[model samples]
Target: MKIQVSTELLDGCVLALLAEKDYYGYAITQRIQQTIPISESTLYPVLRRLHKESWLETYDESFKGRNRRYYRLTKAGTKQLGVIRNDWESYKHNIDWLLKGDNHG
Candidate 1:
């Protein structure tokens, strides 16, 4: 479904990924792309900023002789995700009602 999303949606999507599991950059990028409308070249910056803001933590994982940095939500990040999810759920409900009303009109 093509749901209307705000710019802040990316942050929420990233947090959602962390909620699901720790993800490397590539995995998170793919997951976000699948779930949300990511802006041009915005993924890395968002991840970096989230980490810089202490909302995320990173560690390296090694497999098949290669290592990549994976990200996980911090305690604060989980709290922020909860707040964002609540707000977005309300937004989604309100907008869904609006669109349905428009359809009937």
Candidate 2:
């Protein structure tokens, strides 16, 4: 079954990927696609938004004589990732509780 991913989650995923290391746009989309169903188009705007928000910084490197823009997480992005992770854990726990009808004490 297909599930919709929230924009906040998408941002988190991107930040988490960048947290590991810097990556170009295509590489970021490919890595995210391995776990989530998303198109390259869906990601570009996210990258742009993150860049505008100052959460991500980009640098261009020549790859095969072509400039590839790579994204690196900024301090703000790392802080945002932490917030997303905490929120996800809470959301997941609530969903699991509702689905399983089990107390997670």
Candidate 3:
């Protein structure tokens, strides 16, 4: 069964990818597709939100006679990534415990 992914998780994933290196929108979407099912329509809004939140910055670069907008994480974005990662870890641990029927509460 396919599980639904949350917007927070999607944002986290995007942030994580940007944490690795600057990438254009298409590249980011393609990388995300490798692990999760997401579309440009969904991703573009997230990118805009992140940019507005000052978590990401963008620049246009010429590549083969075309300008590509690349996104890079700011200091705030890095900090946010850490927060998201910690939350994900905690969430995963709880889910695993429940799924394994190891819940003591």
Measured by lDDT, the strongest candidate is 2
Least accurate stretch of 10 residues (summed lDDT) in model 2? 96-105
Clashes of 3: 0
The residue-by-residue lDDT of candidate 1 on 1-105, one tens digit each, is 776665577788888889888999987877777756665377888899899978899999897999999999999999989988999999889888887886574
Better candidate by lDDT, 2 or 3: 2
TM-score of each: 0.81, 0.95, 0.96
Model 1 stretches astray by more than 4 angstroms: 1-4, 37-40, 102-105
**Per model, how many backbone clashes are there?**
0, 0, 0
What are the root-mean-square deviations of the candidates from the true structure over C-alphas? 2.9, 1.9, 1.0
lDDT of 2 by residue, 8-32 (tens): 9999999999999999999999999
> By the lDDT metric, which is better: model 1 or model 3?
3
lDDT of 1: 0.84
Ranking by lDDT: 2, 3, 1
Task: Show where candidate 3 strays beyond 4 Å.
Answer: none
Better of 1 and 3 by TM-score: 3
